[model samples]
Target: MLDVLVVGGGYVGLSAAVAIMQAAPHLAIEVIEAAPEEAWKKDPRASAIIAAATKMLDVFGLWDRIEPDAQPITRMIVTDSKTSDPVRPVFLTFDGAVEDGRPFAHMIPNVSMVAALRDACAERGITIHHGLRATGFRDTGPSAELTLSDGRVMASRLVVACDGVRSKLRDLAGIKTVTWQYGQSGIVTTVEHERPHEGVAEEHFLPAGPFAILPLKGNRSSLVWTERTEDADRLVASDDLLFEAELERRFGHKLGTIRATPDRRAFPLGLTLARAFIAPRLALAGDAAHGIHPISGQGLNLGFKDVAALAETVVEADRLGLDIGSVNVLERYQIWRRFDTFRMGVTTDVLNRLFSNDVTPIRVLRDFGLGVVDRIPGLKNYFIREAAGSSGQNRPRLLGGQSI
Candidate 1:
């Protein structure tokens, strides 16, 4: 029987496989993905991997492969209202860096990270089954039996679901989720500009929502512009003239002519936090466990955090000769991550509700709070570090530059 069977091949599932192998080299691991391998061929909407996450990836031996294509964020320009207001106002701006020159984060394309993960997992002899969607799952005392969409069965000591927000395995295992739609849709697209962004990531918080412009390599920037779902769909389907014109207004003239790249997409925003992270011999990681607004760009990192913690917990349990799939073992994983996940979830939720509005008195107070946080150097570093995944209980392998 296999030691662990991960039901998904996205960032979360692959990361878990890698981390487990590093944490306990003898543990047999496999990943089953529903979609065909690398079939989703498009420029990904991008994910902001914080410094600590980058460290974990470095441990997985992926940093070098992905570095050349990434853009380090050296500065963050956060404005309260308008992107076009030059001298009109400046609520708060964060010059990004750790210590002296170490970058706090890197803007990496989603597809590139997945490619790195897939290749690395393959190199480590992990069985990544693409085109095999999970239909359901059942815990058979000592092991879990996974049922795939194509009438196949895989029995393992532990079953992990990283199959996204609408996870079938999570549902099959009877795990409940607390979820709600944000009404706003994040319209993600890349843009090319005439001038270099100088590694500056800018976020302009409007009444509609935030228009975030994060720098990619060279003259490219990734946009996560929030709008109503209906509006976002129209924008996504609109002509170049209509889309670019609206983009220009919201994007402003900071980086010169901002032409949207061909890869245009929109996803409705929502918050999905699983009620119970584990059940019997089953565990949920990534979107299957919890999902939050992308305003903080913590979605991927949060999933990585779950992967790192759970892998370490399982490995330690194995060393103790305990059943890694036991409810007690899974509960330990839940305990370690629950608070951190809840804390970050609440922060993002409140921030989204606070900024995704135009309440006059509240806006002034929020802007004031922003400037206050920006001015305090020590506090700013703390918040920055927290956002970077350095604030929680991380694994030794993740921290000590070991492969995981």
Candidate 2:
């Protein structure tokens, strides 16, 4: 029997397996992925990885491989305006560096991150099985048995589900979630601009939703443009000329003329919070545990936080000669992560509702609040540290760049 069996071999799953195996090499850990081996290479999405998550990657010895491809967010600016507005006045601005002089976050391509994690797993002798789907799950007293699409049953002392928001393993394990759609779909794409961004990230809160321009390496930027679901589909299917025209109307000429890459896609936005993070020998991490809006760009960071806490919990339990899969042992991880996850979920939900509209009174109130936060240096610094994931107390060892 394997000591740890992780489903969904994405960044989160691979990181979970690698973290445990690196700390407790005596334990057998493996990953099961539903996608083909090369499928991860085709993903064009990029995520904002906070400083705390970089610390974890540094602990895994993979930061050096990823940092070269990442673009640090040296500054962030927030604005509120209409889609037709000629000018977007900035309401809040945050300098990206924390007290230690490290930038709060970096925009990294998803493929780069997964490539580094997979390489780490390979070096650590962790096997990853691809092109297999998990069909069922059963938890006996001693171990959890996972049923695969290939008519195979694998038993492990513990099972970790790092699958996405729509996790099959989460359903098979009888876990329920609080889920709701925002009727919004975020259109994500890569655009090449005429001028350098200078590592500045901007979030323009329009009536439809927040339009974000996150800087990438070189003269490129990644855009997350949120619109109502129906309009989003229309915009994505429109001709390139019309699409570029509409994009320019909202994107402005600050970065000069922009041309989007052909690999653009739209993802529906929603909030999903698992009622429970653990059940018997199974623990859900990443999107399997919770999925939130991208307003704050902390979705993936939350998953990394889960990986840190879960890994530490299991490793320390094994060192103590305890059942690593026991509810008691897993409960510690749940307690450590549950409140934080729920709080973030609520915060994103509220922000999406509050800003994704054109109410007159609300516009005044929220913009005023943003101005207040911007003028107060102490408050702005506090928020920047919070976004960097460095302000919390009693964080996991890995997040602090320490070994378990």
Candidate 3:
């Protein structure tokens, strides 16, 4: 039996495998992905890698391969309404660096992130079964037996689920998740720009939702335009030129003319949180455990946190010759991560609700709160430090820039 069998080969799963292998190179590890080989080939969307998450990648030696292609965010500006709002002007502005003198976040293409993780796993001799799908599983004496879609059986001491929001493994394990669809959808696309973003990110809170312009490699920017579901469907179905026109209208001329990338897509928004993080010999991580609206851009960052905490807890337990899959060991991870996850989930949900409407009272109150936080240097610094990700337990060797 292998030491660990990881379900889902997304960012979180690979990160977990890397951590386990780094901690004990001889530990047998296998990752199963339902997609055919090269399933993530050329995924066009871009993702934000917060400083804390990048540091974890650095520990795993995966950041060096991805850093060259990443776009740093040197500053962030949040606006109450339009770019030219007259009252409650700039809701908030933050320098990109959180603490330890580093940029707060970096933006990289989804495919590039996947490529880096895949390369790292291959370099370490971690077997990734991409084409094989997980069908069912049963709990054996000291292991979990996983059945594949093609009639193959694999056994491991533990099964870690890092699948997406709709996790099949989580379902087979009977782990319930609370989920609700936001009446909104986010339209994401990249654009070539005339002026340099100067590593500055901007979020314009429109009545529909948040319109984020995140800096990207070279003179490009990634756009996350939120809208009501019905309106978003119509907008995405329109002709490219028509869509571009609407985009330009919402996205002001501060950056000169805007040109859309050839591809664009929209996804329905939602919030999902699992009822429990551990069950018997099973553990949950990444989107399987929690999913939140992207308005705050904290989705993947939270997943990285889960990877670090879970990996550290399991490694520590293994080092002590304890059962890594025991309820006690897994609950340690849950205890460390649940509060942080719940806080972020609540924050994003509240932000999404407060900003997705045109109510004058909320608009005024939120804008005022932003101003208050901005004016209080101590409070602002705390917020900034927290955003940079330095205040947490089970921090990995890489999170602090130490080699694992």
Best by TM-score: 2
Off by over 4 Å in 3: 82-88, 393-397
Give the C-alpha lDDT of model 2.
0.95
- Please report how far candidate 1 places residue 331 from its true position, in Å: 1.2
Give the per-residue lDDT of model 1 (tens digit) for 54-163: 88888888989998878899888787775355542666666677643558889988888888988888888898888998886888887988888889988999998999
TM-score of each: 0.96, 0.99, 0.96
Residue pairs with backbone atoms closer than 3 Å in model 3 (clashes): none
Q: TM-score for model 1?
A: 0.96
Clashes of each: 0, 0, 0
Rank order by TM-score, top first? 2, 3, 1
Reference-based TM-score, model 3: 0.96
Residue 380, candidate 2: C-alpha displacement in angstroms: 0.8
Candidate 1 contains a number of clashing pairs equal to 0
lDDT of 3 at 404: 48
Candidate 1 error regions (>4 Å): 82-88, 393-404
TM-score of 2: 0.99
lDDT of candidate 3 over 260-317, digit per residue (tens): 9888888999999998888888899999999999988889888888888888888888
Backbone clashes (count) for model 2 = 0
**Top candidate by lDDT:** 2
